[model samples]
Target: MNGTEEIGCCGAYCGTCREYLKTCKGCKPGYLDGSRDQSRAKCRMKKCCLTRGHITCGDCGEYESCETIQSFLSHPGYKYGKYRQALEFIRAHGHAAFLNAAKHWTNAYGRYPEQDP
Candidate 1:
């Protein structure tokens, strides 16, 4: 599938997620369809995006300063820089570019070498 289908509203590359397809679908679909994964179902970022009629935070005007996204990214459990990088990439290059670059990602989280700061 095109990697866009696996992009999360919170900027995660679900395509590389260990649980993707096994226990979870990508964030957008899972959020829309009422995911069985409780975490996905209850995701604030997903809820916010859907509520705002946005596919992802990249579509929001407040992306950079959004408290919800900031809270999510800063959560200790989600200390990966890749998530932020993905969102920044989306903002700078658009989803297609992010997806194309992310196609080779092997890990669900963590900075891709090519995107390392």
Candidate 2:
């Protein structure tokens, strides 16, 4: 993670989101690059991770049953369940491996297909 690689705390690749290209830079602290948009800044998952000192929700013990997480996962935007999948990948492997998986992931808008997640 170069610190600007927009991978959200929930594991959704912000890089693949159209809104991210237009606004966000990645998941670094807001002061680092000021890339977090209003929505990103308000994200519950992000808040949870930051408060818990975690880089992602995969590091949380309650991720699977978390109501906040489940609610976010139910959003219609992720019809493909990419967030859930990415979290699973991160937990099973690691953030680096999850990033590698995101590099090859073609389902999410294909924004950074050439970059290493």
Question: How do the residues 3-106 of candidate 1 rate in per-residue lDDT, one tens digit apiece?
Answer: 46587888887887788878775666655555545354577887787778776787799987898898777776653466777787788778887777777778
In model 2, state the lDDT of residue 43: 68
lDDT of 2 at 87: 71
Q: Give per-residue CA lDDT, model 2, range 1-117, as digits (tens).
A: 453246677776765566554565445446234454534566677767767767778779998788898788778875437777777766877777666656665545232223344
Total backbone clashes of model 2? Answer: 1
Q: Report every candidate's CA lDDT.
A: 0.72, 0.64
Candidate number of the best lDDT: 1
CA RMSD of each candidate after superposition: 4.1, 5.7
What is candidate 1's CA lDDT for residue 76?
66
Best-performing candidate as measured by TM-score: 1
Which residue ranges in model 2 land beyond 4 Å of their true spot? 1-5, 16-22, 25-27, 31-40, 76-80, 105-117
User: Local error of candidate 1 at 64, Å?
Assistant: 2.1
Q: Give the lDDT of residue 51 in candidate 2.
A: 70
